[model samples]
Target: MSETTWPWGAGTATGIGSLPGTDVAEAQRIVLGELPDLPHLPELPDRGPGADLIGRTGGLLVELPVELYAARWRIAPRPGKDLRRARDLMERDLDQLAEQAEEYAGPVKVQAAGPFTLAASLELPIGGRLLRDPGAVRDLAGSLGEGLRGHVAAVDRRLPHATVLLQLDEPSLPAVLAGRVPTESGFGTHRAVESEVARALLHGVIEAAGVPTVVHCCAADVPLELIRTAGAVGVALDLALVTDLDPLGEAIDAGLGLLAGAAPALPPPAGRAPTSAQVADRVRRVWDQLGFSRRRLAEQVVVTPACGLAGADPAYVRAVLAACRDAGRRLAEE
Candidate 1:
């Protein structure tokens, strides 16, 4: 856990997805200048297609893309070389990011798409169905776990000065397990049981990363209990979509950290960017509803926007992160 109770921070996403043409160092400094409490590393998605914000979080699965669909994932194994070219590319990026993160003095978070989401997004070659083969899913999970261990180490090596937090982005988990993934012809889907096998797959990756991990799902009806059971130290969710806080309340009591998305990711109608006082007020309201005192609230909460600011204007994105930091500070002091 961070020394501060309410460790305010924003997601890796910023207005400009990637830091390509602009100065990466300047971009990170600009973000830190606004929120010094819990500044996460910036994700520069403009780098390329493979470097998409969701894929570059250092938790990529090797060989699964081909297993899913040789033509679709565009994966190929180059011969005569022990390591693949993509792995080399990853190491280069990691080296640069680690060197750049030296300017920030707080813990930095690295984000990645979780296993379920990956399986759903990718496709199978023959029929276009994603790893429907149980064997394929297991292979993907193990490979991802192996990859994450190395990725974590690489980040730590690059930014030894900062505490690295791994964030598993799993917006598709619930739907996938419910067998909601549409068939190629939109006629069929598979329904996975909640506790039986789904939980174990999620748990394996968390255990492999072996670092302080946080699971983030911007969708509504977040499975709070399952996430906590997956051994995640923290869970980030959109407060607006949360219809039930009972499970979250229990998770909090058990010491699971909460990155509560208080403000909307989209621009507000015309109000000033929510102030620390105003944000704290909202926290107070939520706490009162949950029957938890303000003191306890600080220990279990982290103020943030309802979701990533990827779609928001650049100016609004910066403002949101700044607002979140201020709110967290105010609540912590209270």
Candidate 2:
């Protein structure tokens, strides 16, 4: 593990990027209020097309431009309406943050689709998914790196006192590694990307991001070793979905921080929501199972929801964020 200062400091609790609703102002206010320790710039996918992950991230590329075609994001020769719409949405969100976070001084986060996930999702200029061509994938990663550099710069320009953390969302990584991504025609699967190449590209992006980087993959089989190899200081994953502990134990022992998604993002079936004790209990169980000391939990682990709360209703989102904040406090007390 890298022995650098963590941007979130201790007892940090945060959300996984996207929040529910289209009102950027309300989302920013709630996130900043609830997750004061490690608030993230909210992503409102409900804004439709360009606000979704692929199209949203595609807007950040330095020279690369993409357009929505045939229900997929495809490379375009020049910036088009779709690209402009995405950038406009992002800029407006940044403005909302700047307005809402006045005089605030704490760690803030911004997320972008990581390289492999982007490659797996984006279509090449020639029609195939970018993952099909290794050279094209490399080029895309480089472009994304540059794009992310600009993204971080933009966030810094807004939240000047905020120690910004970069979260690289890689939900499709496991599918990419397993060669399960659909081919152009949607009938076949692409060949699995080599782990070495994948790790190297991730490393490049982490370096380019120029902030304390965290790799978030809410997949059951999170590649902890690969994430560590890629120079990510933290590994963010859904603790409940994880069945094995050997690799996680090893990573924690190696000093890699865990952005443990211990709380549920979705709403409850009954009247009351999950208590902070319940959330802390889940994390405590995992720590005990890993044979880790309880005292180090607060500093080494950050409490968060299982994943993005984009699909949840506004009320549920607020409750979940508040629960996460309480969970972090409970973990510290534990």
Candidate 3:
């Protein structure tokens, strides 16, 4: 997508959703302060149960209620305590976001588990994984799509001046495509899904959201082409995990914005942090290696940590976010 059509501006920086603490207000403050150009709603998995990625996203489903059963999220017959708790936690987070960003304008992101990742994580009512039943997976995708439409609308209502961007996290997509997802009995694996099916489902959700969408897959061998075909305006992944640069270069050349995870999400050795120039150089090197123009880096790339900071030290979290923000500015200045 062109810079004019995209939600984020040149040299913008953003996080990959989750943070380490349970203080929603504090997290929102930090995100807004650090990433003024493209702040995201902070997800605090530290809150337990319904606050985690799957549970929180599952709570948003239109009709398919989910509950924590046997230590995993499972489709429930109806709305229950677990589902209610998850939705409540999300509502509280949104309230905090509204309060903190009352006057903030620009692109703000809201995230969720993508259709394939949810399929791999959520269990069926009858005991097997939702991935095992194709029909049920389709139904789940539809529900998620409709749910995301409502979610985008809700965010827009709360932050009236901000343009909402949807991010779909698909950490399990590589496993799903490789047929590595374990069966319910743990004795076998589910069948691999075709790329076309995955693309179609993802496209459905993106279209339903009615906003610019980015697909984040931090794992190795990220399906860059598939994500681009699935209609994501951008692809977010760890730059370190990318062993093959040709696909990345191709994707960028095709006008796909890159959320480059060039900074380390984990704490640096001896508690020392890298400078902004050092962080920005990572993307510059990649651009040079790909033979792309330096000018395009500012327009097509966003600096971020390699992944979520949910497990990083709190001090390191702040440092990393600052590094990302400064790095973006460095890229822009170049």
Candidate 4:
């Protein structure tokens, strides 16, 4: 919680969430091997149905239940096979992680759909997205807060030696703020959520987690100041999409963590990943341009892939993750 106590220690690296395959055991092995300092539980969205971000997170809710209907996720009557499969897959993943990293003792990250994104994606039983109803959105946030607390506690209990780090994935946050989410009819757009409301919703989940939390969005229009003010300890975004550094500077000044997405999520045309020096150079240039002290770069920043590794092949995913770890080591040498 303090500026001096970093969960991943100094100049470490981590992923944005999600891996390349369905083999949960292999995912854990690669993650722990490549990013030892901040290995995260791999999200296997490829499992389909309940394994995707929305269903997986919805399955974690305490009372609220959701189901797939006509290709949309709506509030459900009860936990169906789809959602049951999701929770089962999650349990299996944890079981595999516990077996693989039985002796691991470090910061372990876990991710889920953030409250704003969940509301935008989940359909209400009354025939509309939850984002269209303020009360429904508030209620969903409360539910997610309670669910996340339990999820984090479960991870902590499973890996007692490791510190659990929560990463809330809100890739649709920019659209949520821009009023770009389409209505159920797919014709009209929904109203933009006010900044105050957005901050409160995010704050609720973060507070409920009761641990160091990071907000990750790979979009170009990330709300750096909003998440920082909402109490997120770290902000993860695609470095290639960012240009202005004023807000990032302020965040660093305030002791906020920066998960710099410097490596390519997809394979490069050159047919090989960037070297450690090359990857760290991008972060160094950004730090220099931001007028930050070089000495603090390792303390306040973390190297990561530009986004989730779900699109890449298994080999490419491992290379990108290894590149991130090497980049962090290079940064530490400075």
Candidate 5:
């Protein structure tokens, strides 16, 4: 990607959407205060049903509506109370973000579940998961694309000074690709999706988003090449979970930026948080192992926590965000 097109600048750091709190206002304050350069809209799943990853994204669908059925989000014929609550939660978060960041003019991120993850998680109206029905999957993808386009526009309108960046969370993508997503009965798994199909659907959503997009999958064996081929400007994943470095190296070489999750998301043992140096070292080692130039590290790499901090203690959440920010600055200095 060209310098002008890349959303993140050197020494930029950001969160992976969710934070540890039920208060959206407080979460926004922490995010804006810590990651001012690349603050993401806070996702507070603790707020209940509609605030979760799947339910939240479901609310964004253009025409497709979803409702909570038997504790699982299912496709519904029409918008219901559950769907309304989800949309309302999202709207409130945007309002808080716009209020807090009225004067900010840098890159701001907003996250939603990716097409594959939503397909794997959401249930079909008739039965089983949307993943089982090819036609439903296609419809869901198209709906999600349109939904994301509107979402981006809404964020742009709210934060006119900020460059809105979209991050698609695809934590279940590896399972969907590997046929590991279990069926509703739990007796068998859904059929694996072809790489070409996955790439095409992902590409459509990226185009629809109409922003500099990043795909975040913190699972092991992240399909780096596929994501890059699908037109993502960046890939976000936990560096610790990466068992293979070759694909990562190849993707970086292919001009895809890296949102490197170097700081641990969970609280450390004995409450010993890693210093900024420790967090920076984690990413530096990866770059050295990949044999990438140090000069490109600051520009091509962004430091972040290993994953969402929603499960973490509030104090730990603040520490991790600070560590990531300082780590990014450290990389720039080096």
Candidate 6:
């Protein structure tokens, strides 16, 4: 298979809802069977709340368990080293990746919570408040960076032939920096004076990950400059929520790969999957709105759902994944 200069592919996550313990190999088979050239591993979400997609992946933060525990984000000390357990879990995941490597013949992605989200999710033990403490935030970021580096190396060792893409999920970034994340009492939010503080910490992780990075955010107001400044090669965003395209257009023109959310994350209308023509039309519409030529579309974009399918109905989830693959094909042919 010839490698395109940009990432022209599909987003990953298990069918929005799937039965528990859906074999990783089966999920990989399902994706590759439908879209052979660009399949990514699926994230099974039935693993319980703590085992939810982000939580499962974000377990990398286990490296900061003591710090996190002190902050009240996690329960008091257990009997073991949380970081070691996390590494073991990650290794197991990498082993699964190795098993599915034959199916995913293109870029292989592994996503985890970004630094900002971790900071927000972790509570400080002192006041049982989130690690919104500026100094603590920095500590969390460094720990995340170090943990991510170890993760990348593990994946490389396990799946040596694949081009690894580390995806940083940062849904809390804008809210964290803008003070939109409300306090426990819900009366107000804490604002970070230097948004750059968070940005720089995230940037450090991206740099340290030692692989091409994509910062994914399903929320509004994705900070284009911050993402680019972090040295990310791609940005995955929910297309339905894009109100402003100017900055995105500039970024696309600047050679960033876009995992365009062309397909809806929810199930399509009824038992019907969205047809190729409909998806092609949506892609065309978005590009036309940007005033970009059709010929350049393939080089700049990959089709995906607006976000992970963790909350959708199971049948609909499968349909959406199939729809996204078909949509990418239809758009490419168009």
Error of 3 at 128 (Å): 1.5
TM-score: the better of candidates 4 and 6? 4
Residue 196, model 2: lDDT of: 89
Per-residue lDDT, model 3, residue 177, is: 92
Query: Residue-wise lDDT of candidate 1 within 95-138, one digit each (tens)?
Result: 65666565555566767778777666655545554447676667
What tens-digit string does per-residue lDDT give for candidate 4 at 149-260? 9998888778889889899999999999999999978899999999988999899889988989999998888988889889998999888999778878888778788999
Q: Which ten contiguous residues of candidate 1 have the minimum total lDDT?
A: 10-19
* lDDT over C-alpha atoms for residue 78 of model 3: 92
Cα displacement (angstroms), candidate 5, residue 245, comes to 0.8
Q: Global lDDT of each model?
A: 0.64, 0.87, 0.91, 0.88, 0.93, 0.65
Q: Write the per-residue lDDT of candidate 2 for residues 31-107, one digit (tens) a residue.
A: 98899899998898989988999999999987889999987998899999999999999999888888988567988
What 10-residue stretch in candidate 2 is worst by lDDT?
1-10
For model 1, what is the alpha-carbon lDDT of residue 257? 81
Score candidate 3 by lDDT. Answer: 0.91
Per-residue lDDT tens digits for candidate 3, residues 1-334, read 3444566888889999999989999999999989999999999999999999999999999899999998899999999999999999999999999999978889999999999999999999988889999999999999999999999998988999999989999999999999999997889999999999989988998998899999999899899999999899999999999999999999988988899999888876777666778889998898899998777888888999999999887788888899999999988888
Model 6: number of backbone collisions = 6
Distance from true location, Cα of 49 in model 5, Å: 0.4
The candidate, 1 or 5, that scores higher on TM-score is 5
Candidates 2 and 5 compared by lDDT, better number = 5
lDDT of 2 at 104: 73
**Against the true structure, what is each candidate's TM-score?**
0.83, 0.96, 0.98, 0.97, 0.98, 0.85
Residue-level lDDT of model 5, residues 147-260, one tens digit each, is 999999999999898898899999999999999999989999999999999999999999988998999998997999999999999999999998889999989988999999
Candidate 4 weakest ten by summed lDDT: 1-10
Off by over 4 Å in 6: 1-4, 7-23, 66-72, 75-89, 102-105, 268-271
Clashes of 4: 0
Model 4 Cα shift for residue 190 (angstroms): 0.7
